[model samples]
Target chain A: MRTTLCDRLGIEYPVFGFTPSEHVAAAISRAGGLGVLGCVRFNDPEELDRVLDWMDDNTGGRPYGVDVVMPAAVPAEGSAGDLGELIPAEHRAFVERTLAELGVPELPDGAAERGGVLGWLHSVARSHVDVALNHRIALIANALGSPPVDVIERAHAHDVPVAALAGRVDHAMRHVDNGVDLVVSQGYEAGGHTGEIASMVLLPEIVDAVGERAPVLAAGGIGSGRQAAAALALGASGVWMGSFWLATEEYRRGMAEASAMQDALVAARSADTVRTRIYTGKPARLLRTRWTEAWSAPDAPAPLPMPLQNLLVAEAHQRISAAGDPSVVSMPVGQIVGRMDRVRPVADIMGELVADFASTVDRLGTLR
Target chain B: MRTTLCDRLGIEYPVFGFTPSEHVAAAISRAGGLGVLGCVRFNDPEELDRVLDWMDDNTGGRPYGVDVVMPAAVPAEGSAGDLGELIPAEHRAFVERTLAELGVPELPDGAAERGGVLGWLHSVARSHVDVALNHRIALIANALGSPPVDVIERAHAHDVPVAALAGRVDHAMRHVDNGVDLVVSQGYEAGGHTGEIASMVLLPEIVDAVGERAPVLAAGGIGSGRQAAAALALGASGVWMGSFWLATEEYRRGMAEASAMQDALVAARSADTVRTRIYTGKPARLLRTRWTEAWSAPDAPAPLPMPLQNLLVAEAHQRISAAGDPSVVSMPVGQIVGRMDRVRPVADIMGELVADFASTVDRLGTLR
Candidate 1:
C-alpha cells in the first residue's frame, strides 16, 4: 500500500504504529511500516537514550519515529520536584480515598512511580526530542498539539520530519501554518488525548484543509486492513494506529503490566471504553475500569488541571499496576479494543493489514 | 454508483437522502437517489397521507422511503394532550424567557402550531408507520432506534424493507436480531439524534457485527462522494445522508425557513455545532445558534426528558421560525454543514458525488 507518504518516509507501507515498546517499534519498522515509539514513559533521559539506541541496533537499519507529549499549552510551570506542589490536597485526598475504596494495594518499595507530572512537562518532552534526535530517527511527532516552532525548526535542521496530532481542522491548519511535515487527524475514538470529532469526519476535513500543505494521517479506531483502506479512501496519506498494537506479542513481551491490561482488553467491547479526564486533566479514552468509575462517581472531585491531575493519579496508577488487579488497572485504548480478541505478532498483523487493504481496494474497484 | 441496495430498492444510486420536505424527497428520487421523507413533522395522519400522495405524484415512478422517530424507549407515557401536563412549568417558562431574550416575536395568528408533542409520541409514530405503509414507500426507517418487533414484522408482511438507525454495535445487532433488513449506523457527527460514538469507529463496528445479517448504511458526516466511497470501502452497503441536502435548492424551495438556515449553514464551520438535549430531550447535533447557546448558559435549567422537552420548546421553535431570526433559529445539522457552502440542485450534487467516488476509487486503485 504505497503512497506519497510511504515513499517520503522510506517505508513500504504508510501504516504508522504508535507504541511505547522498542520491540514493537523495531518489529513494525522491520515489517515495512513506521513504528513510532511514544516517549512519555521515559521519565529519565538516559532511559530514553538507551531505548533509542536499542531501536537503532534492532531495526535492521529501517526507519522509525519518536512521539513525545508537548502540548502547545502547559498547565503548570515548574521543575519535576516543584510540580508536585501544584496538585491540590483535595485531589490527592480524592485519589487516595478512591483507591482505598477500590481495594487497591499500595505499591511495593522501589516499584518506581509510573507517570508523574514531570513526564508531561515541556522541559522533559524537549529532552525526549533531543535524545530522539541523537539517534537515526526519521520522524518526530508531538502527541498533543503542534510542536513549538523552535522544535520544528530543530527537527528540520536535523532533516527529520515533524508531525503533530490534530483533533480538529483548525488544529491541522495551525500545524500546517507552523510548517509541520504531517498532521495526524485523531478522532474522539482514539486512545490518548482526542477531540470530540470522529475520525471519519475529522480525516476528510483535515485532508481538505491541509492536504496541499502536508499529508494527513488518519488515527482513531483503525485496527484492521478494511479500516486502513477506508482511511486512505478518505484522503489520508496513511493510517496512524496505536491501540491496534496493544494486543501484539511484541507489546506483551516488553511490558509485564500488559498481562492484566491485555486480559481486560481482550474481553472488552467498544462500549467498555470511556473518555475521562481522570488520568490527566485532558480527556483521554481509556478502558473503563474501577479506577475510572471511581472518578466518575457523582460526588467525585473534579479532576485537577493537566500536570496536576497527572500528578494526583500517578501514585494510584503505580499502586494498581503493582497490585496486578485487572479490574482497577487503567489502560489507554480505543473502541478498536473490541476487535483485539487475541495476541499476534507484529509481522502477522502487518501482513494481514496489507492483504486486507489490497482486497478491500480490489472490492471497491469492482463497485462500478 | 450502484449496489445491491440500489437494485433492491429500485433506485439508480445507493444514496438515501432523508428530508422533511416532500419536494426535496421527490427531487432526490427523481435524481436517482432514494429520498426518505421524514414523517416526524407530520403531526396528523391525514397530513402524512397527503404528503405521501404528493411524493408518489411527483416522484414519477422512482423509489422513495419514509422515516419515523420511534424510539425504543419512550420517556413519557401518555396521550398527546395529556403529555403536555407532564411538562414542568419551569421548562415552559425557560423556553418563553429565552425566546423573549432572543427577541423572537410571537408566532403570527394561524401559524398552525407546527410540531406539538403529539408528533413524537410512540402512538403518533406508529400511526405514521400505518399511514406510510399505505403509500408506495420503498422502505421504512426508524430514526431513533430499532423499530419494535411488531413494526418490523408488519413492514415485512407487506414485503417492505425495515431499516433502523444505530449509534453502536449492540444497537445494530439488536436491530438485526429484530429482523431489520438494513441498519443506518448513525455516528456522533451526524445531525439530529446520535450516540457518542463517532461514525468512523461506529460504522465499521456495526458493519462487522451485523454485516452478514443485514446490510449497513453509513450515516453521519457523509456529504460528499469521497466520504461515501470511504463508507463503502468500510463495508457499508450504501450512504445515508440528511444534512447534505439541507442546503440544496429543493430543500429551500420547500421550506421558506431554509433561507436564514442556509445562510448560517454556509458560513458555519465544523466546530460551530453542538450536541444538546434542549431540543428533544435527546442529545442531537445542531448548529450552534443563540437558541442552543441560551440553553447552555450556566444558569439555564436542565432540559426535561424526551417528550417533555419537545413539548416545552415546540412553541418557541415555531415563534423563532416565524420571526425569521437567524441567530435564534436552532437547525439540526452535522459537521458536514461546513461543506455545504452553496445551494445547488440535487442532480448537481449527485453528479459531483458520483464523479468524486469514481475518482477516489481510481486514486485508491493506484495506491500500490
Candidate 2:
C-alpha cells in the first residue's frame, strides 16, 4: 500500500480518513492511516483547541491533519443575528409546519442548542486555520474550495502541506495556480456539497491537468480496498474516504450523531440518497428522508444560499434530532453508504483496506 | 490485456467499442477488438439488414455485436400519429423559434431527413432486434435497459449473449435476474441517456452486486488505457467504450453525422457538457450548445415525455446539422471528450490502450 503520497505524509497506507470525531481521527492515525479531523463543526475556538490537544495526545506521535470549510467565494458579510434575520417568514412557517406534521416535539425549555451555523462563515473558517496551525497538524485541507492565499502561505510557513477539494478540472487548476500542495478530486456521489461530475471522469481529468504540479487524492464513493487500488490506477496518489468511517466503532462510540446516523445508513441503499439544498443551502448528498422530500415539495420556496440556508434549518434540525426522530434527522452521507453494513474497529477497517488493495493489485497482475 | 471475458467472447483485448457506423464497427473488429454496431439510427429493418450484411462481409470472420435501444418499459400504447399528436404545439414552436434565432438554415427540399425518432419507440426497437438476430452477431446489447424477457430468451436460443447498460446497482441486479449475460455499468459522465450515479461508485457497486452472475463491463468516461486498467482493478471484466471512437478516422469517414459532431466534441471540456432532456426526453449528456440553452430558458415549455420529446426535436436537429452550425448542433458526448483532441485510426487507439494498460500495471507493481 506504500506510494509516494504515503511516504510524503509518513503513513503506512495511503488512505486518508475524514471525520469530525477526535477519537476516530486519533484511532485512524494510530492504526497507520492519516486521519483528518473535520473542524467545521467546532464553532467554539476553545472546543476546537481541546479536541486538537486530545488528538495530539492520543495519536502518540502519529501524524494527523485538520479539515476546515473555507470557500473561495464567501457569502455576504453578516453576524449570526443578521443571517437569522434573512430567513423568510414563509420558510420559517414551512419548517415549523413540517415538524408538527411529522409529530416531532419541540426542545425542552433549557435544552442546549445542538446545531450552530457560525462555522460556515469565512471569518470563522480562518480562525479554524489559526487553531489548526498552532498544533502538530501535518496537513490543512480546505473542504469547500481553495484556501485563501494567506491561509496557504501560513500553512507553508509552518511546513504543513495544504490541500483543497475540487469537483472539476478548472477548479483543480485554480487550486494548483493558487499553490495548493494537493487536490482532492471529489465526485458527485460524495457527501456534502459537490459538483455534477463523477469521480471516474473527474479524477483522471484533474490528475492529467495538475498531477505534475501536485498529487491528487480521489474521494467520493470509495469505501473498500479495491476502490483505493482503482483510485491509484486512475492516476490518483491516494484515496480520501469519509462515509466508510461513519460505520467504524470509534466514530459511533465517540459521537451520538454517528450512532443515530448508523441506524439509517444500515437500512439505506445506493438509490436511497438524493442531492438537495435543504440541509445546508448547498447541494449535499443525504439519505432520502421525509425532511428532504418536504423541502422538495412544489410549494416550498427555493433554498437560501450558503450561510442563510444553514442558519434557517439549524434550530429545526436541533428540535427534530433532540426528539429522537430518526425519520427526519439530517445525515450527510454519500452513495457509498449502501456498503456500510456493520460497525468495526478502525484497525480492522485499515487492515482490510490494505489487504484488499494488495489482492486487487495481484489480481490485476494475473491479467494477460 | 486478456481476461476471462476476452476468452469467453473470443476477442484479443477486453475492449468493446460501440458506434453507429458499420464501417467503424468492422474496422474495430478487424483491429482485434469487438465492435458493437449501434442500430438505433436504423428505423427501417431493411436498412439494418443491409448494414449487418456489410459488417459480416467486411470483417474477415472476426466476431462483432449489434446494439439496440429496447427499453424495458415501453411508453403508453400509441401509433406514431398518436404520439405525434401528443406533442404540444408550443413545444414545436419553441424548437422552430430557437433554431431560427440561432440562424440555422432550413434543409433543402428532398434533403434526406438526416435524423429519425421512430427508432426510440418499442416496435421499431423490436424490429432492430429481429434484423440483428438473423445475422452472425456474437453479442446483443440493449442500450436503454434490460431487454424484455422474451428478447433475452430469443438471444440465448441463438447462442448470442445478452448485455444491458445499467446506471444503478439495483438496475444491474434486475438485469441479472432477467438473465442478462453481462451488465455494462455506465456513469453520469457518459454520453446519451444516463443515471445520476458516477462511474466510480456505479462500477464497483454493480461488480459486487452481479459479478458472480454476469461479467460486468465498465462504461462511461473511459477513453484511454489507464482508465481501462482502473476499471479492471475495480472488478469489471472489460470496458465498453463509445465516445472515444467518435474521434477515430474510421467513424468520421463512415458517417457524415459523426463528422458534424466531432467539431464540437474536440473543443469541449469536461464541464462543457450538460445533461438535459431536450434532445431525447430522457436526461442525456450533450455538449452544451445554444440548442440546449434555448430550451432551458425560463419561457421554454417543459419537455414532453420519451418518444414525444424525441419526435419534437428530431426534425429541428436535422435542420440544424444540415446547416453545418456546430454551435447549435446536438452532439451527445461524454466528459472524456476533453481528452479526445485529435483523430486517430482504430488500430492506433487499440495499441495505445494496450500499451498504457501494461505500463500502468507495471507502475502499480512498483508500489511496495
Candidate 3:
C-alpha cells in the first residue's frame, strides 16, 4: 500500500480521503491516510480559517490538505448578492416549481437563506488558498485544474505542495508544466465535476504522461482496497477517494442531513447515477433521484453556467437537504455508491482498505 | 496468468479475445487465449460456416468461441429488403446527405452494396448459432444478454458453455440464473453496446454477486497486462478484451478498410469517443468522427431502434470506409484507443500482456 507519494505526503498509506466535513478529514488523517478537507463549501474566509484552526488541533499531528475550486479563467468577480441577481428569473422559478412539485418543504422562519454560493468565485477561492497556506497544511489542491502559476509559487513558499485534478493526459502534462506537484487523475465516474475518461483508462494514460514529473493519484469509482490495488497496478501512486467517506461515521456526525444522503447512496447500485451539468454548471455524477430526473425533462430550463447555477440552486438544495427525503435529495456521488453499503468509523474503513489491498496483492501474486 | 476460467474454457490464459475477423480470432487462439469471433457480420450462414471452417483449420487445434446477437426479445424476422422499407425517408436522406457532405463517394459500379444488415435479424443470429454448434466451437456467447433458456440448453446439450455480457449486478445475477456459465461484466468504457457502470465499480459488483455461481470476466478499458492484472485484483476471473485486438496485424490483414479505422483509433485519445445510438439502436461507444458528429446535429433525425439503425447506416458506413478517409470513418472502440498506438502480431500482444501481468504482480508483491 506504500508508494513514493506516501513518503512525499508524509502519510502511512497511499490513501487520500477528500471530504467536506472537518471531522471526517481529521479522522482520516488520524487513521494514517491524508484527509483533505474540501474548502468549497465555505463561503467566508473566516469560516474556513476557523475550520483550519480546528483541523490543526484535532489531526493528531498527521498531515492534511485543503481543496478549492479555481477555474482556469477567473470568472466575473461579484459578491453573492450580486451573483444572485444575475440568475435568470425563469431558472429560479423552475427551481422553485420543481422543488414544490417534489414536495420539498420551505426553510423554517429565521433560518439563514442558503441562497448564493460565492465559494466558486475566484476571489473567494484565492482567499481559501491564502487561509490554507496560513495553516500547518501539507498540501493544497485545486478541484478544477491547475491553479495559476503564482498560486503554486505561494504554496511552495509556505513549503506546501500543490496538487491538481486532471481528467485527461494533456491536462496532467499541463498541470505539471504549470508547477503542480501532484496530479489527481479524476475519472468520468467521479463525483462532483469530472471529465469523460474513466479511471481505468485515464489513470494509466495520465500516469504514463506525467508520472515522471509528478506522482499520479487515481480517483473515481475507487471504494475498496482491491480498487486501490488496481490503481497502483495501473501506475497510480495512490488512490484519491471522496465518495466512500460520505458514508463514514464522522461524516454522519457533522452533517445532520447526511444520514438521508447516506441512505440514498447505500441503496443505490452502480448504474443508478447520471452525469449532468445541473449540479454546478459542469458535468458531475450525481445519484439518480427525482430531482435529477426532473431536470432531464424536455421543457426543463438549461442549467446556468458555473457560479450562477450554484447560486440559482443553493436555496433549492438547502430545502432538499432540510426536507430530509432520501429519494429526492440532490447529492453528488460516484458509481462506487454500490459499495458503500453501510456506515463505519473512518479507522475501520481505512483498516479494511489496507488489509484488503494487501490480500488482493497477495492473491494476484499467486496468478502465475 | 491463469484462473479457473482458463481450465474451464480450455485456454492457456484467462484472456478472452473478441474480434469480428476470423484471422484475428484464429491468431488469438493460436497464441494461447480464447478467441471469440463475432458472428453478427455474417449475414449468410454459409459465410459464417466458411469462416468457422477456416478458424478450425487455422487455430492449430486451440479452443475458440462464437458470439451471436440474440436479443432478449427477438427482433422482427424479415428479409433485408422488407426491413429496409420500414426506415423513414428522412433518415435515409440524412444518411445520404451526411455522406455527401463528408465527401464519401459511392461504391464503384458492379461492387456489392453493403446496405440492409440482415445479420441483426433474429433468424440470422439463430442460424449463426445452428452453424456454430455444428463446428468445434468451445463456447457460445450472446452479445446482448442471456440467450433464451432454450438457446442456453441447446449449447449445453453439446457440452459447450454459454457466456453473456452483463453491465450490472442484477443483470449478472439474472444471467447466472438463466443458466449462463460465464458472465462478462462489460463496463461503460467498453466499445459497442454497453451499460452505464464503469469497469472498476461494475467488475467488483458483478464478481461479488455472481462469482459463487459463475466466473466473471472484466471487459472495458483493458488494453495491456496491467489492466488485466487490475481486473484480476478486482475479482474478475479473466479479461474479455475486444478493443485491443482491433489494432493487431491480423485485424489489419483482413479488412481492406481496417487501415483507416486503425489510423483513426491510433490517433484518438481516451476522450475522443461518444456514446451514441447512431451506430446501433442501443447506445454504443464510437470514435468521434465527422460521421458521428453529423448525426449529433440538432436537426439530424434520431437514430432508429437497433436493427433498424444499423440498416439505415450500413451503406453510409460502407461508403465512409470505401472513401478511405480516417477522419470520417465510423468505428466502434473503447477508451483504450489511446493505448493502441501501433500494429502488432497477436502473439506479440499476448506475450506483452502476460509479461506485464507477471511483472505488475511481482511489483505489487514488493510494495509492502
Number of the top-ranking candidate, with DockQ as the measure: 3
Model 1's chain A TM-score stands at: 0.97
Best by TM-score: 3
Evaluate candidate 2 by giving its C-alpha RMSD to the native, one decimal. Answer: 1.6
lDDT of 2 by residue, B1-368 (tens): 88898788888998999998887899889888899999888878999999899999998899999999877788755666777788888887888888889998888888876344677778888898898899999999999889899989999999999999999988999999999999999988899888888787788889988968999999988988889988999999999999888888887674576666778878778788899887778899888988888888999998888878888888887887777777887878888888888888888889999999998888887773
The digit string of per-residue lDDT tens for model 3 on B1-368 reads 98987777789999999999999999999999999999999888999999999999999999999999888878877777888889999998988888888899989998798666676777888899999999999999999999989889999999999999998888889899999999999999999889888999999989888858998999999998899999999999999999999988899775888888888888888889899999889999999999899989998999999789998888888888889999998888999998989888999999999999999999888775
Provide the DockQ value for model 2: 0.74
Q: Evaluate residue B6 in candidate 3 and report its C-alpha lDDT on the 0 to 100 scale.
A: 79
Q: What is the TM-score of each predicted model, taking all chains together?
A: 0.97, 0.97, 0.99
User: Can you give the DockQ of every candidate in the order shown?
Assistant: 0.75, 0.74, 0.85
lDDT of each: 0.87, 0.86, 0.90
Give the Å shift of residue A86 in candidate 3: 1.8
- lDDT for model 1, on a 0 to 1 scale? 0.87
Per-residue lDDT tens digits for candidate 2, residues A282-330, read 8888888888888888988898888888888888878766666667768
Model 3 DockQ, alpha carbons vs. true complex: 0.85
Candidate 3 residue-wise lDDT, A178-285, digit = tens: 999999999888988998888889998898888578999999989999999999999888899999998888997758888788899889878888999998898999
